[model samples]
Target: MKHTYAPIGLYSLCKPLLFRIPPEKAHKLSLRALGLAGSLPPARYVLKRFFSPDTQSLSLFGHTFINRIGMAAGYDKNAQALDGLEGMGFGHIEVGTITPKPQKGNPNPRVHRLPQESALVNRLGFPNDGLDIIAKRIESYCNRRNKRYSGPRPILGINIGKNKTTANAQAYLDYKECFTRLKDVADYITINVSSPNTPNLRALQSEEELEKILTPILDIRQKSASHVPILVKLSPNLEHNTRTGMIQKLVEWSVDGVILSNTTKTSHPWEGGKSGAPLHDATLSLIQETRSRFPNLVIIASGGIGLDGDLQTFIEAGADLIQIWTALVYRGPYLLRRL
Candidate 1:
């Protein structure tokens, strides 16, 4: 007798049908399906076999991840579907670019797909269910850890961002709020300052501003009885020198890790931030430059990683871990399994 895995095939067949709908709607539907499928024991086992990676373990920031492959933030905005995602073989799942308060985000049509380029453009503005809600969800998920599951639990990385409407001067407060709430449950925290959708958000990446924001956050983390690792997400569009300087600042601040290159805002042939194939060069360059300067820093490469070759490039470029969101959208869950 032979066993068959049909969901991936079915998903490939149904993708065109899903694509006919709005991109965001398709995304929500996919997420819903993942959540439902994960809840089912038999289906989850099949998915784990098909998508999960059997690889050597990795140690970073004092925690061990099942594998180097992780789901980038923005997929599970409210931390709702982590178990489902883990069931699909992601070693680490980063949820949310969450804010202190609930926000509606930019508007409809914020997420656009470019099938020709196998990429996506999103200006979601970090809309989330707020830090309090996200914290509760994570706590609940952790509480259910004793329950049986198909595979090992995935590491949870919570990515925090300022609310779109929040004032820049008050941004630290928002980040602190989320950190305080999610610290106990999150395996790590990613301080996101790279998204281009929010007004004046990227400005925080500057040395002067970043110092002010990070100093207090770092203090809070140090003072806490439970210490959680912190990583900062950087933009790929910044000049190489600027990116290097940011890395240096991160090292000086004693940040635990760095996510090299978020979505690129440069729109050459495609709209939105150029991801996938287009971002490979810039992302690789940034990673290499940062690695050269800060060899000890934990580097999680994010941009342009869609294939094994791209993953190899990042690893060679000195990345400690790798993440993919656009690739998962373009290539489906099989990419995780393959990696």
Candidate 2:
């Protein structure tokens, strides 16, 4: 045994200390630690041995993923910790729900924890360092690529959104600006129309509105030599009929993939969009429905997943890959090991 007890014991010892701090502050501190650890190979070796999956190969979109699990978006909105994160063992990491221009997202006290539900509620509003800054960082990583940073520089997936001030009618242009700057760096792109905190952001999910926004991006993507994959992040709050309609449209547009959900605006006793336990049933339904509608489209599932058994539910519902955020917060870095 490669000292199995050590990592979990360390996490148990440190858990109370981390939980004592404010959730957002603790999150920032965790990312900083990861960034520092990125430069220490011996530390990474120990961490990887303890947490990384035994089998590290998955095929999707004709590309091989170093593993099946990925760190969902929101963990790295600014692409600041890619090297360190890769060392820790995520098959891929999606960075940003970044906008065309830099933005200060919704004011804090924006994230909340619901221990009762084993969940989280966040209205972080896509705070990011903008596409220009993010693109440069990704290109820099690509230039200095190493074996530790496996599988196409760990599949840089850019998630785009409209600026807080942008009108709903012009949201497509905002996505265009981000795509134009980021296409070269992004292995795949996710058009985010599901964030609950941004005003009218979810309206773009409507079929007529979605076509207006997606049509141009698809045209641009098709014309490009890179032919980078494109995906859409959807909301789980929609009625069954609407969700089915959206899947049909995604197939018709030939989108490269679909992220089954973003967080939802369901109000529990805690404020913000509910994620983790409460989202489990609804998210599964969305995945099951979408999979039935588009058997061939790659589906990346997220929302409300906590335990090892939850992974099987998502897989059975037709998710090609699964993502976890709240569980990572509550379960510590040893999450992948448990899975």
Candidate 3:
């Protein structure tokens, strides 16, 4: 297929305007635009042709990803922007840190930009449209069929979390419900137990607590006719022994993958977890150590990825795949092409 290139310096020219909007508002606006373009046939065609990256594929978890870069969760917590984002050349789009029920998340001004740092600190919690609606949205989008569009389809993963109102002991029920509801639609499922903003959520990262959580989910996966990969997302702030202990539990349960190093609380003075250029070194270290200890484990690296060099660094560090959230915000959609 012939491609129509976007005009040079398009995002550079638009960066100032995007920066002028409040971070959360600008995020919603961009998702709306992408959703609109993705919903319309002509616009979808133009987008796919213009932004599709050169095919660089890999196989994992019994699926082939067209590229190594994925859009991390929280960017499209409701799955509203998959088509446009997929068109923009991401190998996969992981949506939601979804809970059992809808939530308002934290108040406004929860997402802050550190332009000089090329980073973002977010305390948005896990606000989303809940399991039922989000699952349906994904199902409807998947039902559209990939044949209508060119290029390999991007893999879809759903990240699940507990509602803020749920107690730590009851959190497994929330995760189980989300997994039971979303598994059919999701290519993979990520259990998010590491978001710093969620009260006591990170406590679930403990081996004992994680076993309570993963047991039921793994039981269900065992019973189901289909096997969907289940991954755990770990906080970047974990001490060495704590992190490795968690991984040992994961191995014991035979979980499919691990997303190393979510946003960090120590990297900046901000009140929330930070992601961007500052996160690269710590994340890379996590990837290296985790890879060394668990040679065969599938590791998805997130945090602090921006340039092509960062991509190479993660890959060299033994990351099976890399995810971009803050970098996408800083560099624009064109970042995918550059990667």
Per-model TM values vs. the true structure:
0.92, 0.93, 0.94
Candidate 2: give the clashing pairs. Answer: 276-304
Any idea what lDDT model 1 has? 0.80
The top-ranked prediction according to lDDT is 3
Model 3: pairs clashing at backbone N, Cα or C within 3 Å: none
- Order the candidate numbers by TM-score, best to worst: 3, 2, 1
Off by over 4 Å in 2: 1-9, 146-153
Report every candidate's CA lDDT. Answer: 0.80, 0.80, 0.86
Candidate 3 per-residue C-alpha lDDT over 94-157 given as tens digits, one digit per residue, 9 for 90 to 100: 9999999999988877889888778789999888998888889888888774556554688999
Clashes of 1: 0
lDDT of 1 by residue, 34-149 (tens): 88777787888888888777766878888888888889888999877766897887878999988998999887877887776666788778888988888888887777654664
The alpha-carbon RMSD values of the candidates against the true structure, listed in the order shown, are 4.7, 4.0, 4.5
Return the lDDT, model 3, position 90: 81
Residue 22 local lDDT, model 2 = 84
Model 3 lDDT, residue 232, Cα? 95
The 10-residue segment with the lowest total lDDT in model 2: 1-10
* Candidate 1 pairs with clashing backbones: none
- Residue 206 shift from truth in candidate 1, angstroms: 1.1
